[model samples]
Target: MSQLPKRIIKESQRLISDPVPGITAVPHEDNLRYFQVTIQGPKESPYQDGLFKLELYLPDDYPMVAPKVRFLTKIYHPNIDRLGRICLDVLKKNWSPALQIRTILLSIQALLSAPNPDDPLSNEVAEHWKRDEQDAIATAKEYTKLYATEQ
Candidate 1:
């Protein structure tokens, strides 16, 4: 018997009806567990005006474990690695069963606005940010312009 999780259906409906600002996520029709996502960079950050793509997947035991999320867009951020893995506490050890997809996406969006270099996924980017914030920000903006534009 094919059974769709009630929670998943509710989440999808809510996401479609009341989408978050600057973020769009819709589940795949073929596979409800997978979602294609797009997030607009925060205006207050160097990555502003950039469009980032991402993929989200919910495991069978979703609320028991955090969902898997990865960026399809290349971002020049200290907490995001070259492979697009985010080094965020909530995405990892801090995740709670109570957290929903909207909240998780919101946290990811917030991370773009406030990057913490002290604990980073890309050591090189963090070093550059610590050494010269202006230069790092310029580099980030350049990367955004180059990579985040429509192809």
Candidate 2:
């Protein structure tokens, strides 16, 4: 691979040294652009008490294009598909070059706190959420308990 970008290196260092609260991102030794991330579910949300894992990859054009982030741990959210693709504007159309990995991850965390069923990646889940929000929250909590618990 070519020399790693200075910005990526700086971002990686800062992620380690000044980690975000309830979040941890660590780069692979051989692949600095790939990160193993863990996020603590926000309190009062269905995902609360769960620790969700995710993979984040910065493409060559990173910052110019949004990073590719997907949940590694299973979660039941209207905006997150079965394959773990998230439906968030900042990760797509609303992305800006000025945004950093930390901010992106924070946005994902916020998504957990407030899921948008109206604009969803998982239609089935969205329908369920729309039909019965309480039941949907229960299912989300169940999935989080079953899949996101730390070993």
Candidate number with greatest TM-score: 2
Q: Encode model 1's per-residue lDDT on 35-106: one tens digit a residue.
A: 999999999899899999999999998988999999999999999999999998988999998998999999
Q: Candidate 1: deviation at residue 21, Å?
A: 0.9
lDDT computed for candidate 2: 0.96
Sequence-dependent TM-score of model 2: 0.98
lDDT of 1 at 69: 94
Question: What are the RMSDs of all candidates, in order?
Answer: 1.1, 0.7
lDDT of 2 by residue, 103-135 (tens): 999999999999999998999999999999999
Compared with the true structure, model 1 gives a TM-score of 0.96
lDDT of 1 at 137: 96
Clashing pairs in 1: none
